[model samples]
Target chain A: MIDKPFNNKAWLFVLPVFFLVAISAIIPLMTVVNYSIQDTFGNNQYFYVGTEWYTEVLGSSRFHDALGRNLLFSGIILLIEIPLGIFIALSMPRKGFWVPVCLILMALPLLIPWNVVGTIWQVFGRADIGLLGRVLTGLGVDYNYATNWLDAWITIIVMDVWHWTSLVVLLCYSGLVAIPEAYYQAARIDGASKWKVFRYIQLPKMQRVLLIAVLLRFMDSFMIYTEPFVLTGGGPGNSTTFLSIDLVNMAIGQFDLGPAAAMSIIYFLIILLLSWVFYTVMSNFGADAPNKEVG
Target chain B: MAQISLDKLAHSYVAKPQTDADFALKQIDYVWQDGGAYALLGPSGCGKTTLLNIISGLLTPSKGHIRFDDDDVTLRSPEQRNIAQVFQFPVIYDTMTVEQNLAFPLVNRGVARSEIDRRVADMLDTLDLKDKARQRARGLSADEKQKISLGRGLVRYDVNAILFDEPLTVIDPHMKWQLRTKLKQLHEQFGHTMIYVTHDQTEALTFADKVVVMYEGEVVQIGTPEELFDEPAHTFVGYFIGSPGMNVLPCEVDKNIVHMAGAKFTLNKGYADLVGKLEIGIRPEFIDVKSAAEANGAGVAIQVTAVENIGRHKIVRGTVNGYAIDVLTDEDQSIPSDAYAVFNTSRFNVYQNSHLVRAHS
Candidate 1:
């Protein structure tokens, strides 16, 4: 073990970042807590409401719809990305000059700002000018994402999958490469079929990275606001109004600060609770995950 | 339980060899008798492991025909070949218990439960892994993991042969000696056709009945350990099979006497055909050492470079007849700065153009 007297010195190193987080995060959190308990009238008049808005938000139908929609979106995103990413990763050649080229292409969308992706897709889906809409209309299919709830949901899910599945593919590919060739040779000598080799050897070896892919995809999809906000604008009658977008609408558009603050607290708690559940399930069921693949 | 025959087996990693310079494994022919313990011994990248993988059906020979017990298996997969292989590193399943790992192949083949249990139990007892049978293999030490791998290889009685690719490499030195002994005993008990591949001469010599010495891409010699040490067929074999290796010196043969460094050494026999391009080889153990000049004491004078006391013997590293040589003597033997080194002519061998010309004078 390292001697602790390396000492209060390491604490000094972390002090700057800690202060920055405290100012930007902790101060606003304290303000939210204050709002949770108190209400104000027109001219800075204050009256203690003490959890009334919290109970109200908890019972609100709009809050329930946002929460459910958020969950459905996260579930759909994870379902689409994990297997599709693994398939792409498996189909790729193990070694070649094309490997780095393929990797850079996969990473292009990830490096772009999320808002820019939204802009690109928004213009790309315009029926009058964009290619996708032009192609679909040219094919004699009636498609309007802005006017139909089904089209809006399908478009949002597709955008999320295209934007995020590469992350999963890259992680799973790294995990697969970490497996030693000796293991594959042993499997071959054992007379294992191709399916068995994949099920028993490759899948178990990739469990740890698969866990990271699952959690990351879940959290990002649940809190997704920018792309759907720009593309569908939570339109076609609230079909794509995930919790993150609903929270913004309540806090800024409607200017209902107290209720939105309560909703924000609830949203943070829900993300925390769901993430904890994912962690517990993965640790218990997939406890034999290959953590030493890095080495 | 089966004889394995490889007929005209050849492999080239490239499309074509330009001037016969690039074949990884040249065309070769050999047969392994059933229930024989054989070893393919060679240094690294000599195609020994590649040949082992091919025979195990992990790699199909680019051009060849393979037969197991008179049945053509050249186009078969590893499953159809009925061969088990143990690798250099431990390859047992980490998630399974030792018993479970040994029983995996048997269960996959739909063997009855009772037979699987009986076989697994027997293997556990044979490997001395009964205590670890219930424990997860992931937590076991490297040696223990290797024991599990060996047990898995031996679990099925229907396998035609068992191939080992330097399986004791990860084992500790002290355990390596013990494991090699255990493997030899297992072969004797089961009467299984076994082929082990290793670069270590001691491991090959002490454990195998027949040793195949390979160099570059071809088997240079195949004989019993005694034959390999007593008469190495190739120069590479002569150097690769012994710890200190054989000492080779360029010499000119005059009748029965070989002349070099302005000195003449008499041989036990005469070889008139080997007059030019002659090289003489002497085992380090067979080189006679002396100190004084009298009678037959006029030995080859050598510049003694260093004398090393290695437990039971003193290895005298020096230059004799302008050629580097090492002569082993008793620990108490005093090697002078300039000493007399003489190889017993009866123990000498003469080579012409890298092939043995005469074994006796």
Candidate 2:
């Protein structure tokens, strides 16, 4: 290797970035860490707690229930969204005037603010006067989101899917469009069926974008708060209180600063670990295509 | 294994073509014999690829029918026509291994597994890609990828014809020759009808038994390399097929004599009163450069401008009465200030309106 010139002045170039990160992220995290290790009472009086909050938060079944709910919600949304998004993207016109129109319609949901989407779904799913609820109640089905936990869950799930599936569609559309026209021509000449073309050509080409979509949707759904908070205010019976909402309730609603800080740290770690796992697994997909006969 | 025929084939990109100029391929009526290796040669935007696409059923001509052994395949798809085409750049399934890429066409047709394996193995060996058989096709070099593209076409044994559209454009210069030789060998061994499209003269001249020369959406001439070289039917052919091309000079035709550039030359055969713009065509290879004393009152004197020493021969570029003329001479020959360009009478061709005028003996 060629010898690189020894230069310590390069470190000066990183000073601005260091200060930016310290101000934006590191400083706040340190305050949370400080709170997790101490007990705070009224008038700023404090005492050393020494991991008591960590033990209580980790052992509580409320935390376990909220974590389970978050996992299930993320899982259900992903299972519905990824395939549906890919289908919508594939069905969209590849050319002509309608392409931009379809793209704009897909993007419309994403442009709406998160809480606005929640409030829109909240009124839309109201059994008293909303169109969907009125139609369901008139059709003889008992649909009430205010009291029934299952109805609340279904409403939120539907609302989330409607709001976010467009993101997945746009990502997958860009991937699909990036594929060259020659590949399609070659596939036609090879006599491949439509399914085979998708499996061997389109699917492989979309792998990178799909990985990104999965990671974003997973993290976004896992840390979901604004929509569910505005829609059901955590739920009829704490059934839809996902991790972020539960953390907010503990930190601000009940003012359990120590335990909530401890819980938030744990929540952050779990997301980091799961995202790493997802990235590792998704990036390795199709690395080595199946070989019937090895050379 | 089928003789492909194009019957009055013409295509226009526009829906309503008002004139011949609108046609991308203007009325091509030719038949490629079974087991024949033909090259469709032309410059870019000359509709060579359009004609190749029509033959492979990737395109349906605006008019006329395409037949493969009496079966009209005008409305058929590429799959229905059983045609194979290798594109300009390599088009391989990136997720497939080299062997799988080669076997794709056969697999899609539902050929027996054993047959696919055998054909793929044979193709791998033929293309010298056996060493990389298990490797993913995407990671290979461009030439290797191109070989896989060619292998995919060759793996199908019963294709009506294999069409190539500038398939070697991405290949390295050295690799182009090897792949071209391999293709020729494969064609000879299997007796498959092949139509290779290219803008390179050397590729067309070397790979084809009969070279179909096209110009501006029209088939100008169809002949062997020798025929194209010896007597180019059109002035464009004479200019396009040669290295320095043919020297075309405006002239007046009178009975059995031709007068050009203030000089007179006699023809072997008499020509009746020719109409339209008249000219004489001669290849640079046939013209001899002589000193003034050596010319002996024959030929015309040209003001020599430049000389290029191209290894085996020297190209003498000169101008006579404002018309540029090139003469090929042995590399060792010395140039004199008073250079005379003697036309080889037997090789001279007369043209009327850019089309060759045959002399009546």
Candidate 3:
């Protein structure tokens, strides 16, 4: 009933979005592509390199290391955040005077600007003045994120968990609330054990939101740079120099704009490819669920 | 077989019930004989649903004792009660197949695998969902999902009772009748103790052996459909158990005569000794339409308002003594502009203070 004739006039309504993306994204993307294929010599000189930068960047061991670290961080975050978030959402109260209070408290961290999280933790993990480091030092433990690669990694991992666990919790709580009470009643009558209820009903019902949680956490953790950058300065012999950090170091520190742009394009492509896989899999799972029911 | 009994049951969702109004469900005592089919019929916000929840052990009553087959189970959980409940909406695992959803209860109880398969297969065939047994529940329509809920309830044979809370509300118009008929057949075959709760009278009247009509916080009357129709024990019952309800006309009762609105009418008997609010109730099915001057049958008179001619019958609506009445006539019956409704005197009952005056009936 809601379907109407497909008119070309609809293009007029979408023109603004098309132009906005083209200017902000398409143009910059074209510039990166141009830089990947071309070489710029000193004093405004130029030469055609034709995929030379791509071969060099792909051959670099530093690129491989950064990609491995990125994948590891995303995997760890997903594993820790998803189940922990579901537990917290399940234990939360549904309706009462304290419901809004509890929700507001959970949301306070999500709204506190991502970069500010880095800065706050930067001062927070300091040995001399930071609360965490001061406590650790007092406990007769030697901890210095600035000098030790292990300390840097743990600090980044813990910081990422603190900042982004709330997002997963929020998404999961919404999914839990969306479940009708009838399902619970059904579970009760079926004499389903508590674990069975969680497995067959609660877990399956949260699939869509869980997918969203995974994608958001993966993208955020993979692209993470600011916190580690401010906390350790990619220090201890570049042990924590993730892709984004290295990209910044190459472009601004070493003045290698061509290679940096090429690396940026490659970085953007990796995220795009993985995200597309996730979207396809999630949507396919959704469509396939119903068809199997009736087929 | 289980005979469910409630002894002096009362519930209040407050710290203390200081007055009668404080109770959400007033003190009620009742019983359902083994294998009896009963319906707790009431409008929304009435205590019928709450009472059902209490008996199901979803809620413990503030003051009561409950028994199943003479076993005191007032402190029992829903698990301990061993009762099955169907919800208003379909509740099924969208990820699981239809056969799996039906088999879930058995598997949870660790029933024998072979028996589980047999029961699940039988249910799939009964519900006509055999073709969909392998498909996930997500693809099924609303009615199909509801049928799964019902099938899951019936798939088990050892449960104490099956409770339905308006299970047909979301079903399609055509499927509602079929599902109701199916449920009736299941009851006849198995004789499971079933307590159905519904606001719709058609469902209650046709499905229940005894309809427990509830109003506000109390059970007003419980009787067979014929008893409720021919002689309503309460004004609420008379106004509830049929389409168009019964017409309640305020009347002044003498020994054998009644005065209403401005006209005098005669009945077979009268209730001069009846106390409290006096009124007469007659079902739409028993009332007949006649010319204004014709006066053979005994009952209050009326003014014809509108005529709705259904294919098989006509519902001729009118008002008598400032109270509304509807008379059913054949589709071909002519309704005069000025008509007098003849309320079948023997079928009518006089209510005093909302309760039936038995002496008059």
- In model 2, the fraction of reference contacts reproduced equals 0.62
Residue B231 of model 3, lDDT score:
82
Model 1 per-residue lDDT at B276? 50
Docking class of 1: acceptable
Tell me what fraction of the real C-alpha contacts between chains A and B each candidate also makes: 0.33, 0.62, 0.77
Clashing pairs in 3: A293-B135, A293-B136
lDDT of 2 at B178: 89
Off by over 4 Å in 3: A1-10, A42-45, A282-289, A293-295, B292-301, B321-323
What is residue A245's positional error in candidate 3, in angstroms?
A: 0.8
Provide the overall lDDT of each model, using Cα atoms, as 2-decimal numbers: 0.83, 0.91, 0.85
Q: Rank order by TM-score, top first? A: 3, 2, 1
Model 1, position A118, has a per-residue lDDT of: 86
RMSD to the true structure for each prediction, in A, is 3.6, 2.4, 2.6
- Candidate 1 displacement at residue B90 in angstroms: 1.9
Weakest ten-residue segment in model 2 chain B by summed lDDT: B254-263
Error of 3 at A53 (Å): 1.3
Error of 1 at B189 (Å): 1.8
